[model samples]
Target: MNSLRAILLGTLAAGLSAGGALADGVVNIYTYRQPALIQPVLDAFTKETGINTEVLFLDKGLEERILAEGQNSPADVIMTVDIARLTSAKAKGITQPLNDETVNKNISAEYRDPDGHWFGLTKRARVIYASKDRVKDTSITYADLADPKWKGKICMRSGQHDYNLGLFGSAIAHWGPEKTEEWMKGLKDNLAHKPDGGDRPQAKSIAAGECDIAIGNTYYVGLMRTNEKEPEEKEWGNAINVLFPTFENGLTHVNISGAALAKDAPHKEDAIKLIQFLSSDEAQRIYAEKNFEYPVENGLEPSEMVKSFGELKADTLPLADIASHRKEASEMVDRVGLDDGPST
Candidate 1:
């Protein structure tokens, strides 16, 4: 009887040591997005596991915050959108590598780090949005956003914005700095308005008849169409249509909202478990549907609003290249003096 009791205790101790509950009480999530965008997923996670999930939401400077908190940070996971943001976090050493096979299989190789430090949950294409009445041509490419024909007719956010920086980095990766900077010069010269605001404002311009073609994300349209509370939002969405450009050689430009486990997480094992759950097929799909984003998981589609945009050939560029060329992109942004990032 003593031998059997000893064996049971040994098993219990093993479970406890691995952080399988009893000791793990909370999961702290640090998110760059506002709670409105991330809360539903957190709620769903809590509902499924009965584990308490808490988020420290922010609109900006989240990366600096994590780095500032350093080892003492209460964060268990860092969630951010865009390759630049994801790479910056890892570069700052705020996170450690997470090389689980489950994440590797569900998230696309192109969207994740080779070392497995971070994994993207959803996809947003940096696609072209053209005013339905103005853009009669269906063959425009991203390069065309810089065309002289588009001068004073293009609407874009600021070059310093992560999304634009990611796009610029991708361009530099594909076209090199000299050529990419030339393109930026031309594109900046063509802007209808100063680069400013989120992509939504660009779409709003299309609805208000402010521009002809807007370089924006496909998912933004989905968010508006699916959840817009105002009739004007419906109008804003209805005024524009999506175009997947440069599919002949390259896919559309893409970015992600990714998560990485904290390096010094108090509950390291539980943090890994939560990441696994978030990167799993079930969670990816639900998050996509709930947030109106494309799942990075293979063979999955976003909500109906996204699918309705029709099939797309995503930019096959590795996300790393986008982050790597950010310095050059920033220089180009300054040289061209594009929209100063929303309301410039």
Candidate 2:
């Protein structure tokens, strides 16, 4: 996924930084990912290479910030969750192509940008949360979510969100727009209530017997079970069992946490090294274990608890194909008023 390199000295030529000495052994990062989610990987990178990692956590506007800063942007790397956001950074022109052999080799062709703009670090499956008491089925499929049997028994978050859009995109990729649109309509018709909350809240809804099943990413269940501050969430975690829902074709849908090199990085070499290290097995283990996500690299396993959910046979529908359809997916959500619950 490598491309012709950008001008390595372009930022310096632009007189960026105004003649101040560039800091040695440091890589500045702007990330949309939560700090706690990535701290271990960053800390490990610094410990191994003696290079300091400076992260600026941003809830939003990571690309806009870099674009606004232009040649003076101190961001050496950009980290974010979801293929939609990662592709957003590339489409916004804030990321440069990476030419690292390590990154190209470690990341799969489907998970990394064909142009080498971004590489996925970890993956989380979009799975079903079935209430232990009310939902007796041991196995389920994504297609079943729309079945009449589950009418008034299903829960989910807003359809417009990236998480749901990614899942919707996969459906579109697998079944085509017309069939996928019909599928969305069926899913909307079966909603237990209006789509109004985050994935974890869907589990809480299930716990309260508001729905027999809910849609959520796999990691949230682990996060809830281990939460110390909100111990009541543990009950939500315990009340439902994680069910890796598959397509009728027998494959689950998953999304990624990925990163890109800044277009005007001040520490290009160090930033590349950081990306390389993160792709290594050691860093990947620490990363996936800490977050209960699956390593994007092949052959590496997820944390034990995550594994306890069940093995995931992920749908090979290329994420690039799915991402391309997100706009239509969102539009379909509004067209059907999916967030307004099932229309009687």
Candidate 3:
């Protein structure tokens, strides 16, 4: 870990030296989100507030990178996907609590940290993609995925992937470790083949009749449907119906792409302004339209392509509660041999 941190810091220092020092009017960001996914909102923020912004995109180790930079870290704000990543940033002590009234007012309590350590910008449901030709059921529950009736009729990516962990974590929050473990075992037994590939491939598998149903995020459907470059992806998107599955509590499981105020921020005020703007209606709309994610702010409609997935009644369970169980959920996955697929 130490060597890796040094390499990351060394690479960053070289890049920063070449770019020269950032101006006082700028807020530097270190993010796990891809640059293109967030550029529109940042551009709008600069236009509206006249505060320049810089982004450093990282695929992983965002918290570790900031930690390595320490008090001298140039990061003022951190943006990333998943409740787990957001909460992990806070837990790593790289984040400071943000208590802006505008942010608190715009985002709901369920989506924000109770102590204001992080805030959700958008939501995506962990939904079921059912083959239109093979599946007759219009509605299903997370628990139903384990039923013997669907044996050899499901496909999913690795059970230990962060996305699956988030969903399984929510199950642990709702059902506790024991029942959730049994459900994991049962679900494992129902797999059509060894869990493999990303969410998009699960859809492609459905299109090829490898499985009747699969678990995936809501936005992948929109992405695949709109992808002109890979026209085959459009066929994958069209092969299935997106179903909003619920827990026994009657609410859909959702995760977030969210932001946090970085600790030791050099530009604290501008960082706050940036975070506040993200929670604003304008930024929320931009997020909805560009990313096909449900805006965290109330009364904002998702992109039209997303709306066609039907109404999402997201579970009122605080994401923090779900995040709390992620470690245990991961442990259960290995314990049940979930990623090893079904037994003979």
- lDDT (Cα, tens digit) per residue for candidate 2, span 43-70: 9999999988877777877777677677
Better of 2 and 3 by lDDT: 3
**Quick one: ranking by TM-score, best first?**
3, 2, 1
User: Among these predicted structures, which one has the highest TM-score?
Assistant: 3
Report the CA-based lDDT of candidate 2 relative to the real structure.
0.86
* lDDT of the structure predicted as candidate 3: 0.90
The lDDT for every candidate, in the order shown, is: 0.77, 0.86, 0.90
Residue 226 of model 2: what lDDT?
A: 92
Query: Any idea how many clashes model 1 has?
Result: 6
**TM-score for predicted model 3 compared with the true structure:** 0.95
Question: Candidate 1's error at 232, in angstroms?
Answer: 1.6
lDDT of 3 by residue, 1-344 (tens): 66765676567756543452255888888888888999999999999999888888888888888888787778899999999888889899999987889999999999999999999999999999999998999899999998999999999999889899999999999998989999998999999999999999999999999999999999999999999999999999999999999998899999999999999988999999999999998898897678888988547888889999888989988999999999998888988999999896
User: For candidate 1, lDDT tens digit of each residue in 245-278?
Assistant: 7633757778888898877776777787788888
